[model samples]
Target chain A: MWTSRRRTRAALVVAALSLTALTAACGGADTAKTAAGAAGGKGGGAVLKIKDPGNSGPLAVAKKEGILEKRLAEVGATVQWGGSYASFTATVDAVRSGSINVLEGAISPVLGYLVSGKDIKIFAFTDPVTDPAAPQTDGLVVKPDSPITSVKDLVGKQVAVNKGGRGEYLLLLALQEAGIPADQVKRVYLNPDQGASAFATGKVDAWWAIVRAYPEAVAKGARVVVHGRDLKDQDLNMQAARTELLTEHPEVVRVYLKVLQELTAEAQKNPEKFQNVFLDQGPTAVSGPRLTDEIARTRYAKVPRFATAADGAFVTDVAGIFQKYGVLPTAVNPNDVIFDLKPAA
Target chain B: MTLEKVPLGVPASVKDPVEASVTSVKGPPKGLTKDLANDSANDSANDSANDSAQGFAKEDAPEREVRGGAGATALEPPRYLGGRRRGPVASTAVRVLVPLLLLAAWWYGTASGAISSEILAGPGAVVGALGELVATGQLGDYLLASAQRAGLGVLVGGGLGLLLGVVAGLSALGEELVDPTMQMKRAVPFLALVPLFISWFGVEETFKVVLIAVAAASPMYAYTYLGVRGVDRKIVEAARGFGLTGTRLAFGVIIPTALPNILMALRICLSVSLTGLIAAEQIGATEGIGYLVTLAQQYYRTDYMVLCIVIYAVLGLLIDLAIRGVERVAMPWRGQVAAR
Candidate 1:
């Protein structure tokens, strides 16, 4: 009984000391989380909670190491991350529901949100890195020995594509180029994971794969019928933010992009460090060589910058393709969605 | 899997209510028993029922020796009065050997080209990944976070369920008021409520916790309701005849008689909480076993994916063992009866 009381006393003392130290640290000048509700600080500070993109990039490394959070703190801004989602649709929904304010995604879904009278915008965009040695970010994968070699050959074939997503977008682009009508092919609407299984089990003759799916299919010897890079200018990766947040506190977005730029450069120099962060920190089955190659393909593409008018044309061209295919009733004007925070460099 | 005849000297231990009770402890409630009769019968097609009914295993043309225990040592006129205990080492070894054999098969599959690294990681890769999580201290942190979420969820949900169950089981008004709403909730899939919950609670701990609570509430309510309702009507009448009335009769008779089912409800609720955790932690969770799954899935890391599964399986085993311990402590009569 005596020892138990003594232990409790000692624990209380330690906790008290720790609490004091923590308060002192947190109340320091650089702490951005210090909400100025009645404290009367400038609009430069606000918490920017964004969606996490899971465990395969420099951003993931930032999440694990508190790199982005630390950078935000320096700029008198705080950052919180929502859960990683498997679908960009979920992430967009989170933004729509005000669960999160910012998301890094393809321009397609964000366009839908904008078209639906949501006050969202594309603040930053990445022009696709189209090098010959670049890893494919998206692909219409077929069996190695399949007779189908190009998009034109997809006529009357059962092709798996994520409905109204990058997979469908890529297939639509390729099919348009080959002068084949979208109705000629059977579009099997399935998600990436389902698409992978379907493509492998002979359930579908071809699967338009994207992001993680493309590399996994390639690893399994799925021949590429059409690569994202092969589509020329259609594949523009982007980071979108709600215009409400942008108008209210631009600093949060600014600090976020600044940290991403640094991490993007860091990932380029040591792609393995960022890509395999999950392996070193926790358990993972990352194909190191494949991920490193993927990092090269995506690293330069993630360099944070304001989009030029020419980059907006890709959005217009994509809209035109979707409109021509009659998938979307009308095209989203690039001007309405692209909120250029800075002039073209 | 057929058992031998009683060899002329063996005790009718299989006929004991103690062994019978254990087999039927997880059985369907009284209302569903008629439909489940074929499934529970000795010659049933249900392998799950057969495996769990250890003492009642097919008593046909037999090759059975009292497994892991000394049998028929006193096989004369007076049989052994009490149940013999199994050899712990032997039983545990058999249990441990199953996964080891599976591991061996997995190793062989990977070592050959039969299973590609893309499809599945080797055992070595998974072990290395486990080591990495341990090294970074992520495994412990994630486990603690997940446990806290599940524990809080089960406590709140199970408490609410128990209250409603007892009320509905005892009175007609409660059945009308609470049962219908609970039944409606029970029918709705928790996945369908994700968007609404996020909108209501935001993508934070509140959302995660609420989602888990909602998932845990239904099964707990079902099990507890069945348990309380299964309390013998005759026992209540007997207590009333003795002038025991109201809360007095309930505390002294109905609840005590229904204790076994309540304990079973606890076990089921605990297991259901894990499922809720997986669904809840999919969105906005920073640290948890489920988040590990999200990361592993995102990175397409089969090693981490398998490791997360192992973590869950181990957690489930621990939960089951803990409940068994509780059952042993709470129902000491069980041991006494089984010993006969």
Candidate 2:
């Protein structure tokens, strides 16, 4: 009985070992072949790998209109839209990993990524909040009946932010500009949903939120205490690629940027068409009024000719704020990180 | 050897007259046949005694056989069947092998360029990041903060759970009052209570700690209640006969018997407490292992993220091992019985 059992166990072990060996060999070969194919294909032509941000943004609109696909097709290349990311960080991670080739996110996170030694470069500026005349996309809100009427009133108060991101950066800048010391106010990190809820219930003295949440806050008897635009000029959003991608395929990058610039220009010239495309193709469910309001507020810029002093200064200032708030480990020069890719004049 | 046939209903001493005549013809003594018959009876009585002895041996043979089998199996047991007689070095080697293989695979994959460093960092990078975090004192501070929250949560939650569990297990009325409410609460995932907890406790240290406590409580209550309820009634009666009563009866008879379950519950509660701490910290924390992971994730620093995860894993394993050590010391008899 013992001999038979031992024999059977030995046979099972041998079978398992053989199977594992076979599987590993086949899997390794397949992975190598796939990697080679991907590299060859990328070298031959452009394959624009973009992440779906799961928002009704320009990328979503371009996807809906097939603008990117059409433009890339003209160059005999293809565009591959990857799965939607859960957050800006997730998108950046995907891009950094080369899973996605391009990511569109707010400038704050881009700077944050740069400071942290992620090899990413800005290729285009989209949705600039550069126009000070424009209504602010983000603001600091407080309950209507609250005694806090200004940003300085936030001192010794518990202010909630989406934290360690754009909202926190803006809040810190606003607080500094208001001549309030950073240590005086307590900063609480909450997601947008929680921040709004906290603001409504008076759990937090103030909330830093985007314009999309403004209507809901207002309905809950919250009023804007300070606007983010009031502190400094800000870029609402920008598109970036891995620095390696830029070095390897500058032409492809330029072509892609050119298409984006044209798309921005087209959207600006035909707002109604742009709104309709977004309404038709965007992932979000939007009322006509809200869609119109968002479209009216959005201001897209053509690809910048070069990294301006202002752009460098904006990043430098935000990085300083990040360092001050202990978000960044050390101060880094924004000029060193921002790559200016220009379309043909 | 054949004996002369005796007549039915006759005593062994009273042999047949015909058999006696035959024996005389064979030139044997007249009383010899009677004596032989008596000796036969004595031998029959001895045979019955031997049968009883055989029965006793048969009853005990399987237990001895089982012990022998257990000893043999213990020499090279399967990894999953944790029990006695495993060599310490072999057990440790077996335990460490799988994780080492996993680390090797990760390293190989990264070095071979199959696994991108961006999405998942190499083990070396993660180690370096851990070293950096340690040197900067960030890891120590974060770990300390997280540990404190989890520890406080376990103390408060585990204490309450033990009290409630004892009450419910000991008294029928207590069970009716508390068991139903606890069951209902257990049905809801603890993380779902974040919003409500925030509203009630505010997004402060109190909120995070309470979240961890609430999460840690349910398993403690369940296992402790089960442990107490499962105490042998015979043992309780025996203790009562020995003059144990009331609190003394519970502590002496019930608690010691139920201690294994309570310790098991504590292990489970500690894990849940850590999970709760991470989730709660993610919501509104500026410092902690969870917050560190979040910061790393935000900056796409996979090494830092992985380091925090490793720290959490190591912390959990250490806590579990500590509880297991306590269990071994507390329940020495369990180990002996299992070994046997």
Candidate 3:
């Protein structure tokens, strides 16, 4: 009888558990409804969900200056910011799920999503990679005392990089040009923080990472081991959106890109605005000289005309690298994944 | 059930008394007496001849002695006659029904198509993807590499674990010296150590394998120590009475007695090692099963990702099954307790 009661009790417990699960499952449907409401000018006004992974950079400035939001507010669109440090996966998931309309980072990511059968498009361009006299937007650095003086010296040494990003692809290209097969060098794929710590600790011989850390590494006695230009190629990382989102809301896309260009102009005209944004989001109190160096390195001070064929070729070439490096499934023409708009003439 | 005439057949103790009784009831009157005499003669020849003429004294013997004494009655000992035997058919049906039911529910849930494929892949797609991988020979290569690493780690880890655990269990000084350190090591999360290990070992295969081995060693060490310590003092004393001492005493008495616990530790270690190895492979290696999962995710092959997870689950289950088989072989005395 006790055994039978135990069995009955177990059944009851299972049923109760299932019912609780059902309730949780039902809650997902309610979330969709809330999303619909949020989409339909609910939440006190028109709410726009923007995903910015870091508080640093131009987005930080835009947030503090309140220019983009102010512009959107005039059109009845209330802006909300969400940040993540979870890599492109998180940002891609958000945009693909329609939880966010615009992901402000690398445009090269569209090829990744496209290979996965996503119909997303790059709606706007962000940072530029020009300004050869200035510091590189992306570079490989090594410890000051280390023997790795050039790209050729990186052979048989560990170099930290993110697998899909421009850093890894460019690093591959740099190694090839240096007459080193990729297999000769061990590539340690890591996120920004991991790569940074590894580089700082001398765990990795070199770091192929974002340019934001280039000056910091230099300050810490890690030399500008290899610039992207040393490899003889250019890769542009930019802001983008789903093609459907751009098509249905061309006015919003146009206005957003125009505001971005205006912000770039504003930042270039006054370096303090850029420094304030960097300080608010980072290791505070960057010095005047350091700020100038950072400003100089922040090459997107001039937003590139994103619709030109030259720009299209640049994106296409990067996508091809993504394929060659095995990060992307296949090579996709940038035109297939981009929507061209002549920046309001 | 009335008391029947006692079957004079084998004095009701040899060939089954029940079967003899039935035979007696069915036999012709002319053959009954002759058959009964022949059965008694056969029983006496087999039993008394080999029982050292202690056949009548057997009733006072231990239960084990009784099973060792004679014919059909000895064959069906308390152990043999206990527990309902589950037929192959019922067991097979259970095995088939359980996974099939789970697969059906999964298919139904995913095919309803409400859930995003990225978060949760459909069963059909996962199956199709596995078939494709298998056809492409990639699955075989990945599995081989992963299995080799896991096997090596388990052996090395389990060996070190047993050695240290036994030493720790035997001496208070050893336990005092190692216990706190072991506990601290176990407390540190395995994933956090990956970056450090990668830094130290540079994503080499040795580092990956050793990392997993280290992860596996902890639980094994703890379990083996506990198992050795938990051995009955009386059993040690009893073995010592027969001149067994030190290593012999441990191997012959303590280890056998603590075999179940030691095996349990090994099982836990196997699983922990597998988890650590998979995580290590995921972060760094270009080839193992975990690398395949990452590679698939990079390409947005949801089906292949699902397949990798399924393969991992199956490997874990198979390891557990192998452990159970070893347990049954090592502990024959278990059958006696089950009878009780």
Candidate 4:
């Protein structure tokens, strides 16, 4: 019986090995075809590669609605959306390596890339926070019963933020404007959920939260101490692509930007529809109503036809803040990185 | 090929030399000598009777040597003992070479642009970042905070696990009560319980430490219970024959016998504790190695991230080596057996 069992096992192993060999042979051929297809797109019928960060944002909504793919198809191109990116650096690295064609992220990371000497170009502003009518997304908040009433009271206290990103930048800006020495206030690095919990539990004196979280925090008896919109005139979001991609496949880049512009306009005009799209297609479990409310609170700046001189100046100023905080090693020239797209004319 | 005539019929004279050498080299095996010595000592009160019963001729009887009254008779040198000794320096070199080669590969890959530094920072960049963090005193602070959390979690959780494991392993009622609950907990992934842990303990140091402790406890309980229950029945019976009972029996026989397994369990528990600690710290820590890594990730500082990962790996190795050291001291017999 044991011998029979051993023989059967050996036979099974042989069958499995054969199956694996067959599959691997097929896979190799498929990989070659994919490589060829990806290369072919450089001149014509190229696939427009974009990354989804898995957030309930306009890009995610557009992807879910099939708007990007449909629009690209009109220009004799196809859209290739990759898996959720872990970080902006990963996204940009993909674009630089030609593994991806486009990425959308905050301006700080784009500035970071420019400082690092990567050849990436800002094609369009996705969600610029330059409009005065825009709902305040970034803010500092304090617990209801806490003695820390204002940014001034936060001196010598711990404030929670997702350090080295937008949250830290906003909090530092608030502290600097309040005339509080940087050394006096301690900035505790925590992610949004943890920051909320810390603030609610009094582990931190205050938390730096975005607009979506502000209403939730207030409902939990936390009050906003300062809003980032009030402190600075800034463009928070942008779409970036490799400089090579811009130069070689301007048609693809233009189509992508056009789609993003339309989405931005649609999100502004009818946020509920955008919210419903996000609720159905977003990677998170955020409810439709909450997402709608967040969209309602958000106000987007007018989409620029191209990255202008003023946009470059804004980037330079943001880079200066990053450098001053030691987040950036040195200041970067925004003009060196920002590409003024002329719509393939 | 043609078959040659066989010479198998005339090998008697040739076999003599081989026989002579074999006889010269072979002596009574160590086990036989030791057993004989033990038999002689047990019958020391009747030496003549022992000699007569064993039929040892007066002229051919082996000389006996007693050491420390344990009846350990010296015998011919063990045949495998005369080769050059294995040096610690050679083993240490081998141990160090693997990591050095890996480091070299990483450097080469990055320098040749085979591996993008943007995706993973090269070792040179990581070292520079390490030096910067150390100079600014951030690395030291983060390391201290992380070490404290891991240390406290291991101590508290390990103690509880050891106690519960012993209880469950020794008594049926304890197993019925505690084993089921622990088994259920072990089935749940540590990360899945994070939200529940946060709600229950709040996002404070308490929550982080408790999360690590809970994770550390599961492996400790499993291995300790197995070690205790796996004690040799024959040895326990022999120990019981000596009238040992209760705590005396447990400490004197079971625990010592289970020391090796417990130390092994400790190594695993420490690793699990570090993993849990890192995860917990990632959430709300104001300052820790995990926090440093998180912040580096946000800023896209690959060098800083790699440096923090290397720090974590080194910490794990150091902790594992410390447990191995404890195993060496606690179970010297293990080393003797390994040497043999």
**Predicted structure with the largest TM-score when compared to the true one:** 1
- Could you give the CAPRI-style class of model 4? incorrect
Q: Candidate 2: which stretches are off by over 4 Å?
A: A1-43, A53-55, A74-77, A126-133, A219-221, A234-236, A275-283, A299-306, A343-345, B1-340
Two-chain DockQ for model 4: 0.02
Which pairs of residues clash in candidate 2, taking residues 3 or more apart in a chain or in different chains?
none
What lDDT is obtained when candidate 3 is compared to the true structure? 0.63
TM-score of each: 0.76, 0.48, 0.47, 0.47
Indicate the TM-score of model 2. 0.48
Which is the better candidate, 3 or 4, if ranked by lDDT? 4
Per-residue lDDT tens digits for candidate 3, residues B1-340, read 0125332222333345455434333322223334443433432222222222122123223443454566536333222233586799998798779888988877888999766564568988888777766665667877888887877777666666666676666656567776788888778877777656655554445566768778877887777777666554545656666876555655677667667668888888878876876676654354567666655544335567678778878987888899889978997765543322
- Which ranges in model 3 have alpha carbons more than 4 Å from their true place? A2-36, A43-48, A73-78, A107-110, A126-133, A278-292, A296-300, A325-327, A343-345, B1-340
Q: List the residue pairs that clash in candidate 4.
A: A41-A46, A137-A211
- For each predicted model, how many residue pairs clash, with residues at least 3 apart or on different chains? 3, 0, 1, 2
Model 1 alpha-carbon miss at residue A241, Å: 0.9
DockQ, 0 to 1 scale, candidate 2: 0.02
lDDT rank order: 1, 2, 4, 3
* Docking quality tier of model 3: incorrect
**Models, CA RMSD each:** 11.6, 25.8, 23.0, 22.8
Per-residue lDDT tens digits of candidate 1, residues A219-269?
A: 888898877777754747787788888878776787787778888878777
Model 3 lDDT tens row, A1-345: 543343234333433454465457447645875775566674454445565423235566777777678887766666666433134654565565555667666655456777775557765565455566766566798877889888888878999987677678778878767777778889898866467667766789899867555565666567777777666564665667667656766666666677777766776666566664533311123555666777665534567445555577767777776666677787777667677765557
Model 1 C-alpha lDDT per residue in residues B79-101, reported as the tens digit of each score: 22345766999889988899889
